[model samples]
Target: MSKVRITQVKSVIDRPERQKLTIKALGLGKINRSVEQENTDAIAGMIRKVSHLVTVEEI
Candidate 1:
C-alpha cells in the first residue's frame, strides 16, 4: 500500500463547519501541520472535500 502526506496549508477559520471538522478529523488544526495516512479511496474522498485547505503528496 502507498502512503500520502496531508499538510494543512491554510487556516480553517471562517470556513464551513464541515471543513473545519474535516481538518480536525485529519489530525490537523494549525497551518503547516501534517499527517501521514494510507492512500485509500476514503482518504482521497476526504481530501477532495477540503482540497482548498490542504496539500497532499504521495509517499
Candidate 2:
C-alpha cells in the first residue's frame, strides 16, 4: 500500500467533538503537525471527516 502525509493545517478549536477526535485519531493535535500513514480505507474515511482541517499529500 502507498503512504500519505496528513498534516494538520487548522485548529480544532470550537469544532465538533467528533471532528476533534477524528483529528486525534489521525495522530495530530496541533497545527502544522504531520504524520505519514497508510492510505487505507479507514484512514481515508478519517481524512474525509476532517478534510477542511488538514492537507494531504502522497508520500
Candidate 3:
C-alpha cells in the first residue's frame, strides 16, 4: 500500500480538545512535525477531522 506524509502546519494551542488529541494521535504536536502513515481508510478519516491544521502528501 502507498503511504502519506502528515505534517502539522499549524499550532494546536487554543484549539479544540478533540483537535489537540487528534494531532497527538497522529504523532504531531508542534508546527512542521510530520509522521508517515499508511494510506488507509482510518488514517484518511483522521486527516479529514483535522484538515485545517495539517498538510498531507502522498508518498
Best candidate per TM-score, number?
Answer: 2
RMSD of each: 0.7, 0.3, 0.7
lDDT of 1 by residue, 1-59 (tens): 79999999999889999999888888889999999999888888889999999999998
Q: Give per-model TM-scores.
A: 0.94, 0.98, 0.94
TM-score for model 2?
0.98
Q: For candidate 3, lDDT tens digit of each residue in 1-59? A: 89999999999888999999999989999998899999889889999999999999998
The parts of candidate 2 lying over 4 Å away from their true place are none
> In model 2, which range of ten residues has the least summed lDDT?
18-27
In candidate 3 the C-alpha lDDT for residue 57 amounts to 97
lDDT tens digits, residue span 1-59, model 2: 99999999999999999999999999999999999999999999999999999999999
lDDT for model 2 comes to: 0.98
TM-score of 3: 0.94
Candidate 2, residue 27: lDDT: 97
How many clashing residue pairs, candidate 1? 0
Q: By how many angstroms RMSD does model 1 differ from the true structure?
A: 0.7
| Clashing pairs for predicted structure model 3, backbone only | none
